[model samples]
Target: MYRTWMRFLTPGPAHHRLGLVCLGVGLQHGALPTVGPRTLDHHVAVVISAGTGWYATPDGRRTPVTAPALLWLTPGVPHHYAPDPETGWDEAFVDFTGPATAPYTELGYIEPDRPVVPLTEAAAPRGVVARIARAARRDNPLLEVETAAAVHELLVTLRRARADLAPDGDPVLKALAHDACTPMTVADHAAKHGMTPAELRTAVRRGAGCSPKDYLLGIRLGRAKELLATTELPVAAVARRVGYDDPAYFSRLFTRRTGMPPVRFRAQQARAVPGGYGDRVPDPDDPPMIAGPRRP
Candidate 1:
């Protein structure tokens, strides 16, 4: 006997601008039936939390799947799979597609070439699925955006849970982020870590899905933005804090990357405390209001 709970969604065009939209979600267990010897037009992440199954390609090659695994049924990929007849399986799946899928796939978060992924554990991804399911209720006005947000979280959670990643996460990426404000060149950073520049680039690409220089630049710029938006520091001081010695170069790079000069960005985004600024930026989604000084 098999049991299933599923919801299919059709979000409007405007919601697609959010960059990721959900098409469907499902949670199932028991002796499930075989899936396609066919192809799909969109992507599906079928997460198996329990039991065992076998996945096959159109070429008839089969890959065995145990508990805590993910099946990436990507667009136009011929796929076939089913659970053991007697034991069945417990599974959750999210079907999503949008322009953002291209970049995500390119970034190594969604692997088309490696369809069957072993997961260290499915709990984190399953929790995101449960959130999506809750948002799936009929006539829930926020359904589209809510589920879409959860899909992004789902992708990130799945990436982190990949069996290949160390349980504590990528040490090199962590170290690089820690030292991002030290004004080191990529080669210099590589030497500090006892690696050649080429080897460091490869490691960062594998762990973070970007070149080392790009990764460090992202960290430095993020910190610079936080300082600009929360403090009264001069642009030159902010630049120096984020590893750039030249204020002119920093302003030009910031403008090119963010489409605004630092002063303009500060004017628009500043959330100053009366007497202090925190090191971290608050989440824009639920930022605390900073009350200015009382009127005399």
Candidate 2:
């Protein structure tokens, strides 16, 4: 028999987020009679690291889910599920959102009509249990600092590993990096990777799970977001700094990817900061703008 443990985490409003969890596995069970009135941001997720459980809707729809399962829940769908008290269960839960959630929801990674998304595996819980245990030992105040980091790690890992995922261009992925300071054209990039346009598209989609162009755009947008939060760069400069020559085009693309234009993204973020997100102080010695995302 395998053993799994769980440690529950209650994050306050400031810390509400989705990802890895400090919740160690608890007792194992086949079913449960009660569950939570828990409500998360827009995306609610749960990972069944150990034990057996079922997710139930308000309408009494019960579905059994086992260990090593991952669940992503849609927003505003009231539902509840838990381990069978007789058999017991352990799980880590969290909430997530942003523009990405909508696309993911459409993909059926979660139940569009319902609130919960589930992924399961027999072995996942055993490993996740070990991870949570170790994290708890190293960090006492769960959901304090280390717990958040662990949760993020778990979320990243789980999202990257599911379904019969494709290869996702090992080369194309390698080509596109977070650096948006400068970048090469797709044509040139394809040649450098020794691929034709069609072949390049196929390879990238296979390995990375998205088209090459979309993949590059994602990296750029992610980097842009980092700058918006951490730097004093003006939004226009930030757009060019991230490779878009036209700030307007950059804004459109940014909005499409992040669900907020660069300027508004910066504004909303600045408001979230304690003393405001600092100030936009342009560097006098800033370097010239580059064309695209950086390559490896």
Across 214-289, the per-residue lDDT of candidate 2 in tens digits comes to 7677777877887787677887887877788788888888888778777777777753433433334557798434
Tens digits of per-residue lDDT for model 1 on 1-296?
89999999999999999999999999999999999898999999999999998999789999999989999999998999999989999999999999999999989999999989999999999999999999999989999999999999999999999999875558999999999999899999999999999999989987888999889989998899889888999999999999999999999999998999999999999976676567666799989676788999
Q: Poorest 10 consecutive residues of model 2 by lDDT? A: 19-28
Best by lDDT: 1
lDDT, candidate 1, equals: 0.93
Question: Over all chains combined, what TM-score does candidate 2 have?
Answer: 0.42
Q: What is the lDDT of residue 82 in candidate 1?
A: 96
Cα RMSD to native, each candidate? 3.1, 12.0
How accurate locally is residue 90 in candidate 1, as Cα lDDT from 0 to 100? 98
Q: Give candidate 1 misplaced runs (Cα > 4 Å).
A: 280-296
